[model samples]
Every structure is written in C-alpha cells, then in structure tokens.
Target: MNKTLAEVRTESGYTQEEMSKALGIGISTYNQYETGARNIPVDKVKRISNILNIEEKDFFVPLKFTLSKIKKDE
Candidate 1:
C-alpha cells in the first residue's frame, strides 16, 4: 500500500514549513519528503510520528513492514 504523506500532514493541520520547523529540518526537505521526491530519514520518521500524534509503527504501516516487526519485538 502506498502511503499518502501529503494527506497525513494536511489532516494534521500542518504546513510544510511548520512540519520542517517541528522536525528541525529544512522546509524544502520536508516538502520533498511529503511530495515523494525524497526519502524520509529514520530520525525524521520518528519526528513525524511525534508531530502527527501517532505511533511511529502506525505511521509507517502502509509504507513498510519494519514498523510492524519492531512492534512485535517490543
């Protein structure tokens, strides 16, 4: 399943700049990640989880299996 980064951010009522600031990343970099133009780093992934008020594992479910595996391990 393909994930919708744009949808997630918008639904959380955040603009690219807000997300960038919250994650301590450049706005352009956050935009690229949301637009599928760049890969999101693992550190940013954790930050995104915090910003979106969701678990990191849930945030990544549609994009990967790693999150699920981590949850299982925990």
Candidate 2:
C-alpha cells in the first residue's frame, strides 16, 4: 500500500509548515488534512499532489493488512 500523500510529503522533505506555505494554507489546516482530521478538498488535493510531484490518484493507494484466525482453547 502506498498512500502517497504523507509518504510523498516526507520524501520531498517538506515540513508541515513548508507544505502549508507552498499550498497557501495555514499549517493547522494542512496538518488536519495530513492527519485525516479533515477531508481535504479535491482542488487542495491536486495542489498537494502537484507540490509533491505525484498524480492525485496516487493518494488512493490502500493500506495493506491481514487477518488471522484465532484458535479456541478447549
């Protein structure tokens, strides 16, 4: 899974403050988007994708996980 937004932000070496400045938004708002506390508008998502040099669809990569069966004790 490659949920690209946060990964791209880190890979680009931009702090939240820097990213917010680049996107013309407040740091708190950007943090909300990054932390999933707020849903980022599509236009903002596009701007962030542009700043990170990635396509907006890259943000949709799903997280990987697995479920295991638990055994019952007799």
- Winner by TM-score: 2
**Candidate 2 C-alpha lDDT tens digits along 1-74:** 55546667888898899999988999999998888777787788788888888887767533445889989998
- For all predicted structures, in order, the TM-scores are 0.69, 0.71
Candidate 1, 1-74: lDDT as tens digits: 54577887888899988999988889999888877777887888888988888777765423444544344554
Q: How many residue-pair clashes does candidate 1 contain?
A: 0
- Which regions of candidate 1 deviate over 4 angstroms? 1-3, 60-74
Error of 2 at 50 (Å): 0.8
Q: Where does the lowest 10-residue lDDT sum fall in candidate 1?
A: 61-70
What TM-score number comes out for model 1?
A: 0.69
Best by lDDT: 2
